[model samples]
Target: MGAGTGPDGSSRSDEEWERFLRESMAGAADAPKEPSARARDVAKRLRMDPARGAEGWRSYTPARPKRRTGWYVAGLLALLTLLVVALAPGRTVDLFAGDDRDSAPLAGETARPTQAPPAEEAQRPTAQEPFRGSPAARWASGAAGITVPKARAVGWMSTAEVERALARSRDFLVASSLDRGVLRGERPEKAIALINPHQRDVQDLLKTAFRTPGEKSDPLLLFSRFRPSQARLVGSVVKTRGRLTYQEGERGALQVTADVTFVYPVTRADAGGGDEIVRTIIRRELVMSWDDPDKVITKPGTFSIVSYKYTMTNGGCGAPTGYFTPPFGADRRADETDREIDPYDRSGPVGGGGSGGDECARATRS
Candidate 1:
């Protein structure tokens, strides 16, 4: 049998067989090497799907992430602004400027605190008029300035009980502050009587302060006094301005708060009639409470002092003399650089608790 011959008896050469196999299976002469023209177009369309695809079926392309530089810059600016505000020094708001209870000076208010006269008025008090250049010139005289709020029932206390408590508070303020004798180093008996006896702790402390008036236990914390030998009062009048407010306590007590500012004028005891007068400004804030008569063991008309604080400007920082010694003559030290606060500026309450704030801080004006 020949290798290229079929069983039917036809015969062919090896070359013919090889050529036939190559031509039949390889391809036609016009066939493309890569793809048909239409197939090429389909491949191009698939590649361009990223740029211009139909809605949902083509390759998905996520949008570029939004830039965060602008948001970061805004956050940083806000933080810097907050830090600047926090580091700034604090300022006090005026406490007395908007007091509606005692807005204007009462009628027939003649007495006032005194100071060295301005260029227009004589430099000394001449028995007729004393308030020369005092900032308290417009303030009311003594207890007349302490205006009590209208009493009404609060918590467990009735209207009448509230009124009584208010009256007692006003009287105590007058006795401790406005009484000439008390100011001239006399005992504040009336003020003491108002204190509830059950407040043994306060009573004991008060007694100790009065008995041993020293740097730590000075009675001046509770009452204002001036040494008679050191200085003489300029006149009979002392200017005062303040208001009283009441509220219900958490423990069913009537809490009364008093904020008052007093101005006193004095001269050196041995100075001539024409000598200059100096002033002392004292501001006191005290809270007194009256407990329910039946529920608490309290006296019928007594007050329990909750807290007391004061600020005394222009009162010399002298030794514990139990008196407000206005730096007079050569006694006033020359180093008053940090003592430029205003006495009458009732911006905030006396800062320090218990014993009033910094002593001897002189004011810009008295």
Candidate 2:
């Protein structure tokens, strides 16, 4: 047996020699001449081996350029068309599809009805109601009633309401010729004893002023007319005071007190025989006492007392002039005497006396 045999019964080495001869003869016939010395030197430096050098010299053939279809452009146009359709108005987008249109009127179609004027605005009373049951109304009624009228006028009363309020007050008015003579200062003790059957001595002087027809019966007006000559008498007094006291078994509560003072000038008719009888009446103080009602007693808040003062000169009334003080702590001290504040000086804060030193003097001289 031979080492390795081909189909021709020749050795494998003999076959290989035949194949190499054929390639060498073919290459020698078609190839160009040898390179220059520089090329030879470069090829030697590159360490080219005939078998491996074929790989290094092989050329690269690029793939065919791909054809572009119009599908991508069409797809982009389609996407833009879809976006336009989605965003355009009048597309019937149902944001509130379940809403019932038949149940309510359109906002723009209906108009609102006009409102009627207030009762006060439409019809003013020929004569104002004597007392409005408010402090402002009471003050206004008092001021207007005491002033001389533009023309003679009369005020009406139901007689029922007056009697009711009087009953609550435990007082009544009685007409007496002897009592009427005494208010003009004929006999002081006798008139005082006569009309003061209820023993409300303070009210006896007031009744004398209203005894004339067409004048409203009001304590404030009565008091003002009873004293018509003093300068200090022009202002109204609002009294404020407070006390902290412990009770038997409970915690201490703040007790607040308020009173109104009215001064009237004495006319010749009010004072007979030259007696300087200026009737002064101090309204009973209204008191409000409470615990930490809002539970805000611990916080710093102010309790205030406000007063409105007006002047009556030459039978005409003046507007009210007033002031307000800001918030303060619960432990602050309040003085009733400080109510006589100066109207001119704005530098001194309220609750503190300003140029009030001459007020007493000014009042006395006027």
Candidate 3:
């Protein structure tokens, strides 16, 4: 018979096989105009040795033996053509051609949180919800976050006296750090009044700082304040968080310490019809002692400040104003110190020396 016909007369000559393949391929819409080198070799090998080539593909043949060879070859050619289209370079076909829904997250899986792009996340604050992208968003507002510890008798103080001391400490924190009036460049009278009147030097220093604020006399040392003309408070709420603790000290005094962080949202005075909000974070740690009334002549309800330290984040450094000069827009300056500090960190020792040099360092966050 012709060239290489099967024993059952099912195979066709090379010319007839080529003609049949061309007719069959005409129906494949995605078939390449020309077959690949590998495809041509496969076709040549199959035509030269039909029985060996077709042996593995017999089960896929639904036609009778007389027509099985053509049908099998045609099916394989179509499959290979489809694979070529898929693997071709610079060619792509979307499986979900017309679907409009986002396919980023699979079914039953939570959508990933949208991350703020670079130069957008930490560099600025949101306007509508000032704390939305910050950890302080979940923090309690104002005095609520300054929680007083359970009072217990320490040294010569009774439980009632200890409770009063703790309550007074919390009040001072509110007055100096969170009070709306105090934040607006107003004097922190209540906070300063809580201090012992016997500390003439301390009182004098505070008076000088507020009266004539300078590099050496910073009012920010004792209270959080901002110039009213420079900043407009975004909202009435101020986010705060921290802890209170007490212990016995030398001379039978109750040493009460408070470590607190406050977050304020404000807009520039000239931010007319604009939505630019800046968050100023201040972390203050104060150590105050109440002497035993029975043993020493101490004020009835006043506490003597032993030491005070603070970390100001997002506040304009190098400015010697009575109020905090939080950087806004072009007013942002490069950090004066290389040490990176996180304002939220409270595990370290409180009321200690800062990262050196003007107490200014880069904040890891707002």
Candidate 4:
């Protein structure tokens, strides 16, 4: 950044504070060694008393100068001044003279972080006030090329801070996504443990999963019309991972998310009353929001997973809808309405088309 003027602050309105920050940031890259000092000088020049005029910092000399020092003392003092000037970088007195969290008072007192009125407290906008930063709009295509609106950190968000937030976001996502093994084993407890205990959603999912654990039934799943046989189907399933990314949210929250592909080979009885081999694929985007995060994500990340799945219905083939697409994966074969497939046909993105898949299927059934 280079030195530049900001929004007209000559009027010194509350809005001026933001302008000052804009100016400060404009020259931030080439900032002087003494940034605090530079800030003070800028503030002083802008009028530590923006609301006041000449009465603010008028200077008054004593009635008469006292012959306090002799020439010998004067010479030493001058020499000392020269040495200090040569040795030190530009130095200025504290402008704010107040505690941390940046802000300068416009009333000639010391600068300080401004407190918000009761009405504005909910957002908890930062002390920067005028410089709470700007909004950044971004969008990403999730599981089915469906664009999800998201945000990017802008303004005061240092590159380091953004990266730090994103990394933690990713940590939460990868750790929180559903694990096929856990699901297949009917270890709902294990799946629930992956989520952050702080989230209400985790508790809700847990209550539902364990509502009647010993009975080999899940009323919630049954209520939602999810098949009990789906559990058995997952026992022999395969899943693939896709892209991972992060997005900023309101009040500086960051969200990390991933796209995963789940595949299940099924032996559903066809409407024709004949046995047919079918494969079902679901693409799910798992998201976890990190409103607060550790500076470093050294521990396994945890957050409730929010999921979205996209599978198109098009083919006349009555084949189950599939989700995985090319790049991270390929879409399952789509043209087959009611066509019978070989029990070991592994030609699709998933299922037992290859020899290894055939063997796995045989072993799974056995």
Candidate 5:
């Protein structure tokens, strides 16, 4: 506004002129800012976590402590002790260390080479060993094989014996009543024969949904359905294995039961060239029956699985009803039972199935 006003109120000195230009340049530029809290946290975490870093061992290793006294003498003694231990006969203790005995060796006796100790006898793994196995066959039967898994038994049975049976059973089952192995140029009767060959009931059961103990389609074919043209269990775990518990069933028949959990994660080809995993978990019991407990006890493969039941605890794409046969009704939906659930007791029976039921339900069990 003045005739000749300097920007800084008075006429600009050389120093003031330089300062003004520098201030103007600084004002025109963007403002500097401190890093956000999240960024700072990430940086701090990176400095602490070795996985987030690639430094050498020396970078993280602590520095050596100051030297201590009497170390050389102790080390020398240790070295001498080690030499003595190494040279000692058969790695055994010397009972006559200081005794002056003249029993070095006979004049003409030659030295014998030391012999290694014999290997320890192999023993069966205890229950403490992880039960690495399948749960298909032997477990479905009441028999836990010749050897009692309960300990103090004499027999050689691997933990995974049941798994082998499951794998075999799954592969031999017909895909469906109509979609028999005929697709592979095999006869229907021949396909039936492949299932058990020894047992007619089992063979009949495998051929169709018509013969299931529930009078529905065979669910064993669930895995078999993917075989041949579609997919299979290889490169995946398709077997079922779990712990078996037992109780008394109708008419003194042993209810060899399992709340066992089985997981099978299968890899199959999609429409594209890449593959995807189809994972499933089936938690149920296949109630196999045998009137003569001895037959099953002696040769368990002879046991016949009459009915299979599915609990609410199961998962996957398998249908819960209609497709599966009428199970013991023991595995009926818990909500359908007419009982009140106790809030305090987590282990209490789920109430739903009423004591008085349909006459047919009573007659079926009767």
Candidate 6:
């Protein structure tokens, strides 16, 4: 028989044999011949049982579906994706979501506002007072009452004293001489020296006579000089007053005004003299007014006043005998004479005695 076939002659050999054996064992009259014990044992040992023939050995339990690893892998991939999204900057994650378990905090979320500090304040200047006045006022006032070393007194000097003073004056001038020859065509050294010795004493007298009481020691006289040609021993007097008015506006600032006047003997000597000599008198008047208590609140450093009338007499002298009029007046008549001797003009005219008469005659004759 073939390796897959049974030894029986029947085509269904294994099945027929199994049936025959069952009937023989039951003792049925129509039973077929039973398979020999040796043959049956041989079939069982060969794993060729007729009952399990045709069908091969197989698992007894129901076949299980193939386990799907793809689902688990996909779930793991989703979890990774969620983790990446949560870890990214400027992103928020929900830990309580039905599918996810992990979540992380966002970056740059707790922001706050900032502020700047305030600036410091500015400082202001302070005011101070000196013996004469405030520094600004002092400069503004110019040379009010200062005295130089060689100045003379206001009284008349004796002949001998005058000569001695003149000599000393010349020496002082020589020491302090300046070379103005190139510019003015005249050597001012000689003229300046002529009055140097008497300058200080004379300045003292002027300060006392013209400046305000507290202002008497000011430096005003430094810029002034005595005009000998206009000097005279005349009996005259002068009175003056000054007032300071401050006009404060939108900005922090001040302005000042000064007014002054004079009353004196209208001497013939003062009239014929140069306007420069007369101007000195007016300047003195103004200086006096600046220091007047009733006019200005005199202090060392704080006040400044601009002189309104920086001129001699206001107009012409009312007295006919006077040679020159006040600042605003016409010149005096040449014929009128209530003579007051000019100390500087010691030499009389060619024919008589008046200041500049001889020079006038010479010019006319020429």
Which has the higher lDDT value, candidate number 1 or candidate number 4? 1
Residue 132, model 1, lDDT: 50
| Whole-model Cα lDDT of every candidate shown, in order | 0.72, 0.27, 0.72, 0.35, 0.33, 0.29
Cα error of candidate 5 at position 125, Å = 31
- Residue 76 lDDT, candidate 2, scale 0-100: 93
Give model 3's TM-score versus the native structure: 0.63
TM-score of 2: 0.17
Candidate 5 segments whose C-alpha is farther than 4 A from its true place: 1-204, 209-215, 221-225, 234-241, 248-253, 270-272, 293-301, 311-366
lDDT of 4 at 300: 44
Tell me each candidate's TM-score: 0.63, 0.17, 0.63, 0.31, 0.31, 0.19
- Residue by residue across 1-366, what tens digits does model 1's lDDT show? 434876687887778888878987988787768887876776688687755445434357789998999899999999986776677522111233442222344443222324332323224443344555554665788888777888999878889989988998989999998888998889899888888888877888777877776666687777888888877788898888778888998578999998888888877777563476777778888999888877777788888889887777657675666677777666665424474766676545554422333455656666
- The 10 consecutive residues of candidate 3 with the worst lDDT sum are 100-109
- Name the 10 consecutive residues with the lowest summed lDDT in model 4: 133-142
The 10-residue segment with the lowest total lDDT in model 5: 357-366
Model 6's alpha-carbon lDDT is 0.29
RMSD of each: 19.2, 29.6, 22.3, 36.6, 30.6, 37.9
* Tens-digit per-residue lDDT, 244-306, candidate 5: 333444444443333232333333332342333332233344443322433333234333455
lDDT of 4 by residue, 1-366 (tens): 234434573344556667777888778666667557765665687575576444324456458867857987989989987777677633312322433212321221111113311111122222122111111001111122222223456333455655664555443332223333332333444434556676664456456444443112222221111133322231222322244556664345455554433333333222342232333433344565555444422224444445432221111112111111111112123332342432211222222121111111211110
lDDT of 6 by residue, 17-103 (tens): 688778877898865678888767766855855765554444264788998999999999999878877687333334334222112
Provide the lDDT at 123 for model 3: 34
Report the CA-based lDDT of candidate 1 relative to the real structure. 0.72
Q: Write the per-residue lDDT of candidate 3 for residues 157-250, one digit (tens) a residue.
A: 8999999988988889988887889988888898888988878778788879987876656778778888888886787888777778789987
Model 4's alpha-carbon lDDT is: 0.35
List candidate 2 stretches off by more than 4 Å.
1-138, 143-167, 170-258, 261-366
